[model samples]
Target chain A: EAGVVQSPRYKIIEKKQPVAFWCNPISGHNTLYWYLQNLGQGPELLIRYENEEAVDDSQLPKDRFSAERLKGVDSTLKIQPAELGDSAVYLCASSPRASGGASDTQYFGPGTRLTVL
Target chain B: AQSVAQPEDQVNVAEGNPLTVKCTYSVSGNPYLFWYVQYPNRGLQFLLKYITGDNLVKGSYGFEAEFNKSQTSFHLKKPSALVSDSALYFCAVSPVYGNNRLAFGKGNQVVVIP
Candidate 1:
């Protein structure tokens, strides 16, 4: 089976501009996640969706960042008026099992690297 | 809330030698620990996980991790190092009952000298 897929592997934008990243999860996966990875740091969970419902989004910056999973298969993460600090890698991951399971192993995509100048 | 810590910034090992990357985590109840490897310009790949059974869990690419409840640690180990194993490794943790939010460590860069 194909792994998770992401679009626009690299994106460059000036500060205050809007940027969006898209993700397509593996077939039949039920859970999807969006994470932000800063330089030299591990990924931080921004949002998580179980089917079409966003089960976890406490860490997402609601002021500027928003995400949507229209059909529960593909997701889009958008950052409006992005700041310099928003420059990082945006990663999307999916798991086959339900949420809260210890056996759910998340498969990641080749993240979209955003550079805000 | 749960969190993870990778104590080392980088680990260097010669080929054919044993390799180790240290990781520690903090959680309220029973913890679900995981290890992932990331190559250059690639996504993170699942290596292994420790749930409730044996402390020693084997994973892909000849990687294994030992879960120590007493110390709250899960360290990745490889019996024999290979040049292709050079990459960044991340340790993650999540509570068994919460929203299944994973907390990841800063990641450790491993360099295997050929």
Candidate 2:
């Protein structure tokens, strides 16, 4: 089966511009996650979705960042008025968690590299 | 709060020799640990995980990790290193189940010289 897929592998935008990244999780997977990865650092969770419902988004910057997992299959992460600090790689991941077990390993996509000027 | 720490920024090992990458973690209750590898400009690939049972857990690409509850460490190891094994390795931890927000360390760069 194909792994997680994401679009716009790279994005370049000016400060205050709007930027968006898209993701499509593996078929039949019930959970999806969006992560922001700064240079030389590990990914930090921005939002998580179980089906179409966002179960966790405590870390998301709601002031200008928003996400939507429509139909529980595809997801979009958007940032309005992007700042220079927002320039980073956005990673999307998914996993099959019918049992919600910790053994379920998350599979990741290539990720979208966004650069804000 | 849960957190992971990778003491080394880089680990160099001669090909065909054993290699080890160290990781330490702190979490509340039982700990669920994971190791992931990433190539340049690519996403992370799951290497292994420790949920329960044996402390020694084997995973993809000849990688393995030992869960030391006493020391709060889950170090990744390989019996014989290969050039293809060179990559950035991340150690992550989750305090409980169904919480996908795994606290990850900065990462360890592994270099295997042929």
Number of the top-ranking candidate, with TM-score as the measure: 1
Give the per-residue lDDT digits (tens) of candidate 2, residues B1-114.
789999999999999999999999988888899999999999999999998999999999889999999999999999999999999999999876546468889999999999
Model 1 per-residue lDDT tens digits across residues B1-114: 899999999999999999999999999898999999999899999999998899999999889999999999999999999999999999999988776888999999999999
- Give the 10-residue window scoring lowest on summed lDDT in candidate 2 chain B: B94-103
Model 2 stretches with alpha carbons more than 4 Å out: A98-101, B97-100
Each prediction's whole-model lDDT (CA): 0.93, 0.92
lDDT of 2 at A12: 96
**TM-scores of the candidates, chain A only:** 0.97, 0.96
The Cα RMSD in angstroms, rounded to one decimal, for candidate 2 relative to the true structure is 1.3
**DockQ for the candidate 2 complex?**
0.73
Candidate 1 stretches with Cα past 4 Å from truth are none
Q: How large is the C-alpha RMSD of every model relative to the true structure?
A: 1.0, 1.3
The model with the greatest lDDT is 1
**Local lDDT at A17 for model 2:** 98
Residue A63 CA displacement from its true place in model 2, Å: 0.4
